[model samples]
Target: MKLPIKIALFLMALLSVMAACTNKNASQRATQTNTDKRYSYEYVKKISVTQPKKALQVLQHAEEHKLMSPIDINILRSKVYYNSMLDYKKATFYAEAALNDSDINNRPEQLMSLLYLAALEYYNCGNYAKCLNMADRAITTGYKYDNRRLVGQVLTTMGQCHSEIGNVGHAINCFDRSIIIFKGEVKKSPNWNLYYALTTSNALKANAYLEMKQYKELFQMKPEYEGTLNKLNTLPEGISGVNDLANATFYSIYAIGYEEMGNHAQGSALYDKLIVTRAANTPEGATFVVPYLMLTKHYNEALSKVNEMESVWTRSGKDTIDYNYIHNILANKAKTLQAMGRYKESLETGIRAYDLNDSLNRRIKAQNALRVSEQLGKKMLKKHIERQETLLRINHIANIVIGALLVICIGLMIIGFRINKKLKAKNQAASTLVKELLLYKKQLMDHLAADEANNAKNNRKTLEANDDKQQQYDEFLRMEKMVIDRGLFLQPKLERSDVAKEMGISTSHFNELFARFSDQSFTNFINDLRMEHAAKLLKDKSNYTIEAIANECGVPIRQTFYRLFSKKFGMTPAEYRNVVADE
Candidate 1:
């Protein structure tokens, strides 16, 4: 009996020891899993900016093992999408998910980061209003979290949004605030964020001053910009990773300012420097494209450079072609061609630019629509959560109320569907009308060309019957030289009689001489000269508007100016101006 009792006790002791060991092993596994998850997250964060593809792979591994929480994984995915891939749509998706996640609602820093990322994506998409809204939320979140660096970053972004929308004063003010905040933050050590904020803010401020034509203020900030650049250069490359962008932006601004100030030589030199530096660092990307376009405006070999840019773009991959950059390049090419008096080529290039601009505008509108839908969804979600809480409190009545609400929602959805269908039909009709109008315009242009050719032939025949044809031609040449040399075609109300009196000839003789030698009447000849001058004036994009160009060309009636220009060029004055201005 004693032996059996001892055996039983030993078995009981063994069972207790085994249970203790199992519990300890389980605890150790949980701790190891948590540590692995933390290390994975850290690894991903470290590589997200420098090696995004690698970061993404690690994040996938973490996700597969359920190492990170859903909210954390979503945020990581957002960063990878945005910083690595430049995929704003996917970035926004993950960002929105992370923001809406209940686990992260109280995480102020995470919320602020998400908001800032969204704002940046919106800004890149040209949705300035939405960008501003996101920026404002980020600012609020920054203050709530007492994150000065975050506040400064969002303020700089706000300044950019304001500048985009033509609120230069507001933009400058925001930049100033951001600069002050960054200056304070940089008192400890070389903080890359603070340094970037300071330089970018100052750069933006200088740009605003330049835009407002406050050259003195812009020049005053020159030393500050240079000093900031020097400071940025001192930072390690890992910390100041956007060095190429910073350098390109600074030099480009100065180049533009110099050009605006009529120091083209200095501007051209700066642009050359920018281009060379960008080539070494950034190579064939957006930064390189800026100096390329700026140089196109100032250099004689613009067409060659443009062709090179196209080659670079092609090599960069067609999928990555920035529409805005393409549009700007084409527009610049058109301007350069017009300046070189290649009007036909300029006109064709200008039309392409217009089409691209229209497409880009439509894309921006769609992005804005998405932003608005996001806002609406947030509002609806809040209401939904409130209603859910109310339903839980009144469980007995909840079913009946929910049933009635469901029926109402179904009816409203049906009405919405019908309205959407009607809208679609109306939009299609409008689009068709636009197409028909375009077709009619094309046919009208063909008719005008035929009429112009026939009129030229008839006018030549009408003026062929002169007794002393050679002598008459010599006198006509003298009068033509006088009219051109004196710019007589610039007189808006000058009649044939006025021109004849100025030329010391009878009105009929003057008209006949022009018809014989110039293949047109005196009036038509003067209009031709005026149209040529108008086309040149249209190329000076900064110096004249369409109305101003018309006035300068002595065309008092704007409608008549359009009509005659269309007759002469096979395109309206606005269209011609669009082409010339694109150059």
Candidate 2:
């Protein structure tokens, strides 16, 4: 459904308001905290390199000891994930928590925390529209304060979100702006944000151009194998941002560009290299596994890839909406089935892919809803506090006029006490609502876990069924081989009728035999065998070009050969041959 433009504008306005108010408070806190800076400055610098999980622990200790300001602790809490962990949800949680605190608004770190939370949430959820909104908010705040690094980072993140949602033109605009800041070295030299923003903008611009199918722009931007490899190499070793699974994604895109440019051999080879690099950096031998997904033809391999991605995200405490990674796997697996000539099975896979995508969208929107509720909760809390302060001031003023209206004043005091009691009840209710919101968050995570598990189970069952069918088909292939060896039929274009006649049966009866033995019609079996044989022959560098290979395999046209080879091999004939040769 199309989002109403008016609503989008309204949300943008609300975000602006939130940013303005938060920034005002942040500024005051920043002044107070930095005034006594000797201890905090050294402590903050020392903990910069700490792991996110460990940083959270340290921050918790600081909070307990009353050594850290709520502002400082919140900054640490949010940064623990945003800077160190890459866990978007926790980063968002702490950032939002920090923003909601009346004490932390307007500080540079608080502004950064809010921006980081919003950007990461949008990126992780695949909600480009909201992501862009948050990025705009962050950029606005950062620019107002001359925080160029935050501006650059938000611009790059906006570019990426635009790329993800197919907004090529807008994506490039963001990347261009980010590049300007990046070139100026506006951010601290050693700051990871600089490298991350530049590389992200570059990579995303490449992706945007690729999506547009504009090879010239893509190449002009230096989105090629050699260039990306150089950048990857130049990236500092053990830098968490540069060599992650996402970094390997650039290589994947480069390989894709090569494939699209009709250099499948190079593309396939690059793909192999990409998988190796990704697998190495990916913790626990578990990566996003997109490469394994693209290369392997087997359904089990696809299922395994999804399972591994899910496991890794779970272990890392990453958002479940990271399902895009797994959804891509599911979508590709359907393509693989189509390549394998399993059209019926492919349809089923496609359905599963659709379902998974739908589930992901729903979960993401739900998370966004939770964020909205959190913001609303904070607004209400502020209003309630302000009202209470107003009432206290009013009571103090009323006390001075208390002679004849003493009874009335006492009555007013009793009424105020009752109102306070109700306020207390209301606060308790609000706390319960917050608890429920957290529960909802956990429930959503659990649902994602369950969905993935069920999807894996379903895939395994389908694969087992396919395995059984393949076994039957293999038996039929063996029989066909024996018959061919014996020169059972003279016709070069042998049909099922001939096979049935030779086996002393009617065509219909023979079809039943074919179905029982091959799991598909005789025609599909024949075509699959012919294509498989042609693929094998094509792999022999000594034999033939694609056209000759096609002719020899009894597939008449070059286009048909290209189509069939790609369908059977998950790549073009040349790509398959090159991949085989490289192996």
Question: Compared with the true structure, what per-residue lDDT tens digits does model 2 show for residues 1-583?
Answer: 0111111111221122222223444454455544444325234423543344555666676678666677667655655554445454565667666766776453565666466556655455456666677778887878777777567667756665665566768878987886777657723453333444455556656666776788888777774434433554565533333344334555566666777787778777866777677333343222223333444344565445545644665676665344433344445556656766779978997887666666776565556555655666877556645754785587678766665498888889999999977755554454345335545644755665564466566755665665665644544544565444444432347777777766665888667557676566665666666665665575564467777777677777788768866665455666556545544
Give me the displacement of residue 536 in model 2, in angstroms. Answer: 30
TM-score of candidate 2 on Cα atoms, chains taken together? 0.50
How far off is residue 169 in model 2, in Å?
A: 2.2
Window of ten residues with lowest summed lDDT in model 1: 1-10
Cα RMSD for candidates in order: 21.3, 26.8
Residue runs of model 2 more than 4 Å from their true location after superposition: 1-52, 72-87, 186-193, 223-247, 276-303, 313-583
* lDDT, candidate 1, at 467: 54
In candidate 1, what are the lDDT values of residues 1-583, reduced to their tens digit? 0111111111111111111111222343345446764435445654665576777887787779877667667877876666545555567678788878886665565677678777776665555666787888988877886878678777767776776678888988987897888788778646554576677667667767866878888888899888987797787643213555567666766776777788888887887777666432332233333333544454455566655655665564533324434444566667668877889999998887777666765565555455555667877656645754674568658768989999999999999999977755554454345346545644755665565466467755554653587658657756765666688899998787887899888999877887777766667878877876675566555466678888888997889899877676566666555444443
After aligning candidate 1 to the native by TM-score, how far in Å is the CA of 542 from where it should be? 38
